[model samples]
Target chain A: MTDRRGTDERLAAWLDGAMNPADAAAFEAEMAGNPALAEQAAAWRANDRQIADALAPLATEPIDPEWLAQMGLAESTAVAPAMPPAANDNPAWWQKRWVPVGGALAAGLALVLLVVGRPPEDPQDGGLSLALDSTPALQQAQLDDGRMIEPVLTARAADGRWCREYRIGDVAGLACREPQGWKVEAEVEAAPATKPDEIQLAGGTDNTGIAAANARLGTADPLGAADEAALIASKWGDR
Target chain B: MADPGPDSQAMREEIIAVLPRLRRFCRGLTGHAENGDDLMQSTVERALGRAELFEAGTRVDAWMFRIARNLHIDAIRSVGRRGTQVDIDEIAETRGEDGRETVENRSDLAAAQRALQALPEEQRSAFLLVVVEGLSYREAAEVLEVPVGTIMSRLARARARIDAVVGRSQGTGND
Candidate 1:
């Protein structure tokens, strides 16, 4: 949608931050002249600030561990803005079908809660830091939100597709940046990243994507070093 | 979900760092310090329990938020505390790092609390998740278990209501 159309639908998405970079930019540009839209954005900001500030008090309370531990089954209740059930309607169907077909899968699924409580890493530092380059190099990063990203060797298999592994979400995944776009070859079954480094950013919004793409290139140390920040700044770090 | 690693050590380190933000989000939902900690603890426990459920191709915060939302709803329901609410001023008074002595007029803080508490739960959740907690609409919807469109509408409506409340509060004996 061309953001200039001035529809409430697009505006709502923009306010909620569902807009892609291009759309968001266009929407912001229009906000310069659109009084109604500007007012709407202000009110939204105000509302958010007030609520956040107000809710600040009750955030530190501790739940009775004994109570939480004794909790067996969750209470069945309904609330507003309801959506589809996350679980299948027929639990028996799964019991009869996929359960029998994949024994190991069934075992793995059953052990999920107990086996996977621990995180892949502790997220107490800064964030998921990364270095992307036009050349291949070993890069490590902590994300702004505290998720970590690190990379290593890449090689082409018999089929001639370059394959490498990186952490996505909370698990490690084998991915190939093919002509079609990056695709996960295999997924790592592991705990979630408390501070996730993953984002499905539109074309150019990510500070890391440029570096990731650069690393995709066959170069010496594709992710420039700390001084390289100045170098990247000289080229594309205008922001 | 796909973070680059064998960085279990690294990931654990970062999780420790981000706990404060998670605590903040938890605080927003529970409305008091004690409940917020309980909420955070539940959030952490759930995150650990559902670790494998964390997709390798999604945002980490969004995922934690999903766990947090479920836990919050679960706590509210399990305790059978439907629609039994409390005063926002009391929350601030109880939870404020700096007590009432720090405030110019305590009513401003009180007014802010009342305005937020007044919003419908859906709108309140949407506004906090999007504006304060910084989740995108799709992420917030995922947390709230609703469509992105629903999130947007609730947020918009929440904003309108807050503006009205704040405007009214500004005019009254309070500021």
Candidate 2:
């Protein structure tokens, strides 16, 4: 408790092993005599350990060989083309398209989707599909299951189908209006935001899956608020 | 196919060796698995693209770390977003039914991650590089392009903030 600022710096230096032997020894001796200081030092040490343990799982995730091949560190594996031939032809088409961009997020999203299965064909019975059918972009709505859904962007596909990009909880997805119901074309789990309120979509460039899906569909520019409202009112009717 | 040459081969090997640590560092920086991998990919691409700039005998890890840090900064700037944000409620709901101990451990991990994400970029990077990555303060300073003393002060401040947030969370008895 002598020179609190100096002591804090010394503590951090000692914790990081940045201090020279003599300085570290002196600090250690000070901590030994001062119970409060020792407790503070121990807490900080534990904090570091907690942080390390929290991040350790990320390091242990199996490395994707595509990464090595992308860097030319490994012999080039025959990477799937950026554009898949047909979306419905291969159930795993999204996986191949997203592998080059980075697979961890896509893989996680795929696992969740696999477990949940497709959104219920009957939109009335499905919260996500129901929200997509009606909710306009940039507004948040609560699903029946209690997850928050925010429609991000609205556009039309080349085939005269209406598509909407929306975020439901941590997942961002694209669902196109079809004769049957809103069909989820693609989804990717979004990166967790530091401030949930300030979470911005950044024009959807950060998510390759959504972007690629949009590209393949030849989606026009996202509709403005007024246009989007109109589309919602019309139940995504043909313009 | 042209031989990539000996220097290129050596540089490739060096990068391969550092990939795990670099991936961890990127994950810590980006606060998301996929974003971290994307950044890792971009870092490797940048390093290999600028292979000639790498000094022959210098630490490849440090050099690549600097690249990764700068790229992260640029990304943050481009997106006009500062730090990462985690949904506390989302994390809480995702807890499993394995056991009490498992739930507690996951809760602690989430708290730690949220605390880390709450820090300002400078403080967060310094703490990760020095404490989590086990880099010397000097090496961290080099990677951050700041003086050693700056690293020290940032680390101290970062540690205090983490302690305050985490300590308060634990005291609340709300997981």
User: Which of the numbered candidates is closest to the native, going by highest lDDT?
Assistant: 2
The estimated TM-scores of all candidates read 0.45, 0.54
- How many collisions between residues are there in candidate 2? 4
> What residue pairs clash in candidate 2, if any at all?
A193-B84, A193-B85, A194-B84, A194-B85
DockQ scores for all predicted structures? 0.17, 0.22
After superposition, the stretches of candidate 2 with alpha carbons farther than 4 Å from their true spots are A76-239, B1-3, B81-109
Model 1: fraction of native contacts: 0.34
lDDT of 1: 0.49
Instruction: Give residue B173's error in model 1 in angstroms.
Output: 3.5
Interface RMSD of each: 8.6, 10.4
The candidate that achieves the highest DockQ relative to the unseen native structure: 2
